[model samples]
Target chain A: EDQVTQSPEALRLQEGESSSLNCSYTVSGLRGLFWYRQDPGKGPEFLFTLYSAGEEKEKERLKATLTKKESFLHITAPKPEDSATYLCAVDFQGAQKLVFGQGTRLTINP
Target chain B: GAGVSQSPSNKVTEKGKDVELRCDPISGHTALYWYRQSLGQGLEFLIYFQGNSAPDKSGLPSDRFSAERTGGSVSTLTIQRTQQEDSAVYLCASSLAGTDTQYFGPGTRLTVL
Candidate 1:
């Protein structure tokens, strides 16, 4: 069975603080790993898609890195606007469904 | 639609009532998806539709939940005899294809009382 697990169920950071959230997965073949940021009362907003190990993608203060067993969403100098639930998902080989992990709730206090 | 759009932004209904939620994907998008999110939980995949091909409904929780995509554009999710546990935000997303980045809608907040 394919599974995704995210660490630090919750995180608190002061404005401008930097930290990384982890998303570990167990699957036979990884097609793509997705990162999304979801705000209250809204659906997830696409952030990045990392396809292979050692691959990295970035947007503004967010950076996503992928490996064989896990992915990292590193937030640098975060602001309150960046505070939201970060979700990680993995699409297995030959499968159309995406298995998601319990997201990490981030609170950035300004 | 400019982006993925879902109808009935908020629906408060009785437990036994059946409900249908609709989604209109972005023009020219070939893939549509449905997902649910419990309070403070991550998004859960419900179904996937690619073009006029058969949909992948592997993630549906039960037989009472069904969905259909018409003309490869609009999609609707129907819940029969809603239960309290079914209350959640039902989201719809669309992408250029299965392997591409998905764009999400605001979601329909369903409440069962």
Candidate 2:
């Protein structure tokens, strides 16, 4: 069975704090890993897609890195405006749909 | 260019009723997808349509859920005999041909009373 698990279901941080959210997966024939940001009552906004181990992508203050079995979303000195639920999904070989993690709810106190 | 769009931003219906949710994918995108998100749960894949090929319905939870894409652009997801467990946010997304990045639209919140 293919499964994706995200740790630290919820996190509260002061403004300017840096932290990392984890997404681990157990699947066969991994194809790609994706990261997204979702605000309240909205659909997820695409962030990055990592296709192979050691691959990394960045946008503004966010960076996503991938490994053979997991991925990490690192936030750098996050701002209150950056607070949102971060989602991770995996697309494996021969699969037409993505398997998503539960997501990490991040709150940045201003 | 406009991104994916869904109609009926909110829908509230009594149990046993039926409902339809619509989605317009980004212009020129060849792939469209539907997903469901419940409170505190991860997004669950519902269906996928790619160009003129048959839709991938493997992810649909039950026979009561059905979807269709017309002209390879607009899609509709219908749920029959709604149950309380059916209440959730239904999201739509699209991507370019042979691409992995999926841009999503504002979801439709469905509530069953």
Candidate 3:
């Protein structure tokens, strides 16, 4: 079965602190890996899509890097505004199904 | 309108009551999807619709959960005789195509007491 696991379940960082969130997965084949930001009481907002190992993408203060078996979302100089649940998901080959990780809830105290 | 939107942002009902959640996707988007997110958990795929083809319902947890898309624009997820375990935020999303990246809506939080 395709599955995704996120580590550190939760993280607390001081303002301007930098850290990384990890997402590991097992799938038949990787079509694409996606990263999303979700706020309380809201749906996820698309962040980045990494298609191959060694690939990376960035947006504002967030950066996503992918490997054959896992992906990491790095936040640089994060602010309280960046605090939210970061989710990583991979689309399984041969289907529209996307297996999602449990997600990392990052809190940046201002 | 501007992006994917779900109706009835918050719902509270007793167990065994039927509930319907609505999702309006962006115009011209050919692919629509539904998912459920429980408190402190990840998103779980529920269903998928692409254009006029039959939807992918393999992810639906049970027969009690059913859905339909009308005119390729608005989709509705109907949970019949809902259970307390069904308490979760029902999310809707859409993409240009089933193979493309998807955009999500605000989600409807259902609280089954």
Task: Compute the lDDT of residue A47 as modeled in candidate 3.
Answer: 97
- Candidate 2 accuracy as lDDT: 0.92
Docking outcome class, model 2:
medium
In order, the TM-score of chain B in each prediction is 0.95, 0.95, 0.96
Greater TM-score among 1 and 3 belongs to 3
Better of 1 and 2 by DockQ: 2
What lDDT tens digits, residue by residue, belong to model 3 across residues A66-96?
9999999999999999999998988977878
Per-residue lDDT for B1-113 in model 3, tens only? 59999999999999999999999998899999999999767899999999755458898999999999888789989999999999999999899988789999999999999
Q: Which stretch of 10 consecutive residues in model 2 chain A shows the poorest summed lDDT? A: A90-99
Number of the top candidate by DockQ? Answer: 3
Candidate 2 local lDDT, B53-81, one digit each (tens) = 64588878899999988898999999999
Can you write out model 1's per-residue Cα lDDT over A12-99, one digit (the tens) per residue? 9999999999999999889999998888888888899899999999999999999999999999999999999999999888877778
Interface RMSD of 2: 1.3
Per-residue accuracy of model 1 over B5-83 as CA lDDT, tens digit each: 9999999999999999999999988999999988766778899999866458888999889999889899989999999
**Which whole-number lDDT from 0 to 100 does residue B62 have in model 1?**
95
Q: Which runs in model 1 stand beyond 4 Å of their true positions? A: none
DockQ score for model 1, please? 0.73
